[model samples]
Target: MAVKTNCNINGIDYYRLRVTIGKDRKGKDVIKNFYGTSKTDAENQKDGWMKNKLLGINHISIRDSLSMAMFNWVWDVLKVSGIKVTSFERYEGIYRNYVEESSLGFMILEDIQRVNVQRCYNKLHEQGKSYSQIKNLHKVINMFFKYAVIEGYLLRNPCTGIKLDVYKKEEDVGEIDLFIEDEGTVETFTDEEIPVLLEGIKNKKLKIMVKFALGTGLRQGEILALKKTDIKNMVVQVTKTLSFAKLYDDADNYSYETIVTRPKTKKSIRKVPIPTELKKDLAELNKIRIEEKLKLGELYQDNDLLFPSETGTYIDSRNLLRSWKRAFEGIDVPYKKFHALRHTFATQLIKNGAQLITVSRLLGHASIKTTEIYAHVTESTKADDVQSLNSLFK
Candidate 1:
């Protein structure tokens, strides 16, 4: 090792230290440079590097920063991990939106401490980011740091002891509100509202779509990904879901696409029994589709979807949501989200004596705990059950 004083590079003066850390596979010397404002600073960096090498944390190059390593990890590890494109985009978004330009991203990978990770999360929480958003950010960074530790780029994970629950406000503490979508509150439609809503929708296809959602409890994405072959013997097989997302390319240019992938979890892959009444409506819709396809001939871009756009390609989810909202015009009932159709299905099932476990499977929930939210028995049901006991007193 040699320390050179008063070195000038890029018009900046610094003390530079050069050292031969190791050899390559061909037995050639591997040289490294450490620069700092003073001789003590430069020597301290060199000593730290030597100590890390001795402690078996040696894979990371001194020049690697948090953003540099994170991007490489995302491409090399996550892209090929068989995750959905939407999921991959979500991870990438977290990095770009929260970490890319922050001070945390520019820090040397090996030099980051737990305090640094905590500070980043603290800043995001203080900025009024939702608990879910910050939690996701923590999850990404924590996983990345774990990868660094396993790859020998880091001696220890800085995100080990970080706690996000402590930052959650009282309003955030509650059961997952199935009634909420996109930060909007949507209540389940009552029995009376259901008929009013159906009568109000002028679009023939949108009416059928709403009926399907209520009948089967499928999510919006799952409902949209349905095909003619997915339904048989009055049962709908849910193996996949469709999502619309704005994705960024290598040049950071964004474009929208409809992505189809397997259900988010294994539980989401299920077969739901279609109601007998819904069978006729589905058949009618199929007839309409066949008629349209034949009329269009080669103009149709058929992907064999149960619901397709005007050109027969995957329907944009945003457009579907917009159309759903518009269907309530001049209707007597209050507007509820498309997701409320699913909630109505579960709530009615529980009210009508469906077992909690059965409801869980029908909703494709990963845990029965999530299904507990729908276990609320209506006052009418409770009163009716109590009225039956009056016969014994008589």
Candidate 2:
């Protein structure tokens, strides 16, 4: 049972509930304090503490553990803070991927020292986790403890002044002819592959999507969420991105629910210039869409998406991937991510003597550093540069 002490501090009312957490080495009653503005709030807090103790909750003996603290803070605070839906989902994903499955979740908040958290990170590294993966886990855990400390759930955060390092394993030296360096180069499709990809895509609408991806570096969700109004006066405005709640693909049916939200970052809301050739193609696409809408008559469902299904509703992202796979069926080029098209767009501009800042702006990159990742030096381009050395040798 917790004892409530009512006090008046300089005309302000305050209530404190002190609960017996455990016995110390000296046989003293180890206590935990929860303060509130009202007596009922103090009692409620005490009652909740008692309930946790009775229910054998591991994380709530005195203070919340990593699991409870993270979840409670997220659901109680982050959800109500009006964060973007996509960012909130990503934050939740970190908790699910890192804390939910780890041993650190059940440990007492005070008992978890810096070394204990470090070992957890080391275990993740040994389990072949990437640096980015471990970093995300660290981020969530770090923020969780910070929240706990701020809310008086814990005295100090264990994650304070800590660093994570993931050790990468060496692959077999003779297994492959050439090793792919992680950050040494950016991967993009060759000029020849573009034609094959376009030709392989039978659907005219899907073909237009691939062309747009190559022409502009819009993200998958951004492109899927585009509307007829988004394109105007030889320019495409990227304003919002589509958020998918869940996706289910069955043998007979496929479906998804989407929530349209603002673009991921501030830079993602910029406008991209549509080339002259692409403008003409888009004009023709509009004509085709007008003809289709007339044929469907009252049965057509118009969501105003630039690229919609025959029924005029937003296209399912998964179904769009099926179409993407069909487009690459006969292509001889190696498999690359769909995002590689964005890289291709940037690389073509750089190869044709376009400025770095120009490409950065066109891609809606927040910083020029991000755009640099898409800029790669090809072997052929290097060879051309090496030829310039011939004059110096003479």
Candidate 3:
């Protein structure tokens, strides 16, 4: 229960003080003072305080409260709770962007109201943010408010009732290309440009990497992280990824690190068969590494890294990107991304009349639907097969 009290101010009666019974940090009842002008104002404020207390809102002011910095607090909570690294990364990105651009940065957590949030959203939209981005922003905002409500920051979440026209402004951008019928997105590499592109890369290491990617349908990270132990018979086991490390302040050069992480999905951690033609190439690569190891002697610690640097150190992703760009100078290809090699592998598999299931396995796709993108590319191949079978029947 809360009580309102009045005192004389400049010879006039005014509700200058309000006292509310609330739990302190120890959950014991404590009296809190709220400043107000009128008796009704003081009583209303007291009622709201009691309601908030029942809801378990934090008694501390937003500026002083631990929940004030939504980004930091949420990340700490999620990290301690053992959330997945990839998901936490995305959440962190969203929160970072919001704090940097939204009015939420200027406001204390206690001052966050529905109108304030609405204004923030409008300003963001005016700044030319896409509808999808705005929706994501709203999602993070809602998540912050939801956590606040659950943690007893407020009696009710002010963000609950507001709705936005997120999807209604529909404009049809014509039918998408049906080349890759099952894949929601299209990725096509004009085969005519393959030879011209292959002739450009003079570096044997970079060439081996590019050719291996084209043959195996492995991601850049997965391919670069390949170790000598990963190869057995004609099978390659994907168990780790070489990712570009985040740029560190005061560092003159970027670095790469390998993490023994599973692929994006269960299917992504699959064994892919090496083509018979590349067996000799693989053997040569081993021989070169062995000779290099002997020459380096004690200097070489045997990191077992398949794609080591010129000095037998770990190969950085930035180096790979630079090498790939130099290779692109010789070939005029429509595709500019490094991952296009994986796409090329998928396209070739479909064109060679391999089943979707086999293609899915080779590509380490989690779903058959993911591999079905080749179904569109295989239309001509499938039709040619059908025609040949009909000729046999005749």
The candidate that wins on TM-score is: 1
> What TM-score against the true fold does each predicted structure earn?
0.74, 0.73, 0.62
Q: Kindly give the stretch of ten consecutive residues in candidate 2 with the minimal lDDT sum.
A: 172-181
Q: Candidate 2 residues 104-159, lDDT tens each? A: 76444566788778878888888877665676677767877777777777788888
Off by over 4 Å in 3: 1-68, 83-89, 104-146, 154-188, 247-260, 354-358, 366-394
Selected candidate, larger lDDT, 1 vs 3: 1
Best by lDDT: 1
lDDT comparing candidate 1 with the true structure: 0.76
Backbone clash count, each prediction separately: 0, 0, 2
For model 3, how does the per-residue alpha-carbon lDDT over 229-333 read when each residue is reduced to its tens digit?
998998899976665543222112223334444556666778889888888778777777788788988888677877776557667777778888877763666
Quantify how close model 1 is to the true structure by its C-alpha RMSD in Å: 10.0
Better of 2 and 3 by lDDT: 2
Q: Model 1: what TM-score?
A: 0.74
In candidate 2, which residue ranges exceed 4 Å CA deviation? 1-62, 165-186, 246-256, 376-394
lDDT by residue for model 1 (287-347), tens: 8788878889999989888887766888788888889888888988887888899888988
